[model samples]
Target: MLQYFTLPVTAFQQNCSLVWCDETLLAAVIDPGGDLPAILAQAERRQLKLEQIWLTHAHIDHAGGAGELARTRALPIVGPHPGDQFWIDGLPQQSAMFGFPPAEAFTPTRWLDDGDTVQIGNETLSVRHCPGHTPGHVVFHAPQIERAFVGDVLFAGSIGRTDFPQGNHQQLIDSITQRLWPMGDGTVFIPGHGPESSFGRERKSNPYVGGT
Candidate 1:
């Protein structure tokens, strides 16, 4: 079975997740923004063997620690699509601008697309290229667990900001309605920040994209 724990990391309180397959004790860390020590400690406490680093996008608050973590553990980096390469390349400047710890950029072992599937141990997750938040943004959906790790796409009562470079409000709305809605209303989503919420709830109450 696939199980996960959400850990708030960095000053941004980015919700980094540690997802593992119970049967094999193998795991993957999603969006390790910073504070690598705490992340590694949690995985060790759970007795999970860290296998991969999966990113939803290359924003500073979501991907700051990926390079260091992957280099230290010799784990492969995956996802976020190819469109976020520019953001990845700007990690150093982003870190300085945000007052975050020094960050390094690294190449992903695999650049995910709309239909790619990622695996950890015996479990698999379907990847959806949900852009607008970032052109390369992707969401990891675990059908078996009815969970979607959506980064900076949709929130409990709002949607991602479309003011950044290449950000488009219409594109973000389309990603939410077209790519995310099909995942099922009952599915619980972990946003990049703040509390988790079900798609059904957001659909009925979210001011930005509700009533669809």
Candidate 2:
């Protein structure tokens, strides 16, 4: 079975998830923004062997610590699609702008696309290329666990802000309706900066995309 723990990191309170397969104890950190010490401590407490760094997008708050973590731990970084290459490249600028610790840009070992799959020990998660939040934003869906790690795409009552560079409001709306809606109403999603919410509940009450 796949198990996960969410830890809010950085001043932005980005949700960095530590996911692992209970059977193999092999773990992956999703969106490791800042606060490396805390993330490492949690993984140590769980006795999980960190193997991979998975990214949803390359925003500073979501990927600030990824490069450092991967370099130090010898872990491979993955996902966020190829479109976010520029964002990854701009890590230094973003860090300065956001008043975060100096961030390093990194090259992903694998750039995921829609319909791709990532493995954590024995568990498999499907990847959905959900843009709008960032051109290369993605969502990791674990059907077996009925959970989706959705970056700044959707929240309990709001959606991602499409005012950043290359951000398109229409594209974001389309991504939510087309890419997320099919995940089933019962699917629980972990957003980038807020509490988790179910698709069913969001659909019924989220003003941004509700009643659609």
Candidate 3:
């Protein structure tokens, strides 16, 4: 079984998840948004060396602590470009604007392009570029594991806010319809915030998707 650990961080209270294969000690961090200490502690407890830090999007809350964690583990950070490199360069400002603490930012090692695959443990996570929240948002899908780390895309009963620097309402809708919905109805989604929900559940309940 793949062990999962969650650490809620920063004023945004973003959820940083550490997913590891118990047998192989291979690990991946999803949205190392903040709380570098907590995330490192969880990794050390399991004796797992973080191989890669994956960003679902370029939002400050999701990518803020990425630099610290990657520096600590000497791991690589990978994610989509989001076309908001300026926002990435201005993370500290966004944090202060939102009453969040100062943040350190860094560019990704590789952009999360659609059809990209990241290998972990004995399987692979198919990268689906599901933008809307940001121009380069992505969802990591591990088919055999029946799991996906959906950045800030689709939440439990809601969806990502499109008022940010790179956010868009119509694009987000298109992302859900064209990029995410095809992941199969039973796929389990571990969102960047809030609780876990299945693709099936969100399809049936998420107002934005279920409504219009």
Candidate 4:
């Protein structure tokens, strides 16, 4: 079975996820936002080697620690299709714009495609390009654990904001309907911030998104 830990980091408190499997001992770090210490602490506690750092989008709060963490762990850093490459590449500028400490530029080792799979333990994480929160936001769906580490694209009772650069309101709505809601109602969505909720709950209650 897959085991998981949540590390809520950065000023905005993005929930970075550390998911691993007992048998294979393989692990993947999702959105290592900030506070490298906590992410490392969980890595040490679980003794699961981080194979890769996967990003759902390019927002600084959800990607701040990615460069440092990957360098520290010697893990490959992968992002969502590079549509947010500008944001990812301009992290320092983004930090400055958001009134934070200057950070170094981060270039991911790999740019994940829509149908790509990043194996973790025995299962495969299905990548679905669900932009709108940012132009490259995506969600990693792991059926074995019935969990999805969605970035700003999803939340408990609300959806992600579409006011930033490359953010599109209509596109975000379409992504939710076409890419996410179709994942079935049972999928447990672990968003960038706040408590976890299922696709069913969000479909039923999210004000910004309407259910079919």
Instruction: Identify the runs in model 1 with alpha carbons over 4 angstroms from their true place.
Output: none
RMSD of model 2 against the true structure: 0.5
Ranking by lDDT: 1, 2, 4, 3
- Residue 69 in model 1: lDDT: 93
For each candidate, the alpha-carbon lDDT, in order, equals: 0.96, 0.95, 0.81, 0.84
> Residues 99-195, candidate 4, lDDT per residue (tens digit)?
7566657778989878888877786779999889888888898877788888888888888899988899898888888888878899898999999
How far in Å is the alpha carbon of 162 misplaced in model 1?
Answer: 0.9
Looking at model 2, the pairs that clash are none
The count of residue-pair clashes in candidate 1 stands at 0
What does candidate 2 score on TM? 0.99
Candidate with the larger TM-score of 1 and 3:
1
Least well predicted 10-residue stretch by lDDT in candidate 4: 98-107
Q: State the lDDT of candidate 2 residue by residue for 131-150, as single tens digits.
A: 99799999999989899999
Per-candidate TM equals 0.99, 0.99, 0.92, 0.95
Q: Model 4, 212: alpha-carbon shift in Å?
A: 3.3
Candidate 2: lDDT over CA atoms? 0.95
**lDDT (Cα) of model 3:** 0.81
Count of backbone collisions in candidate 3: 2
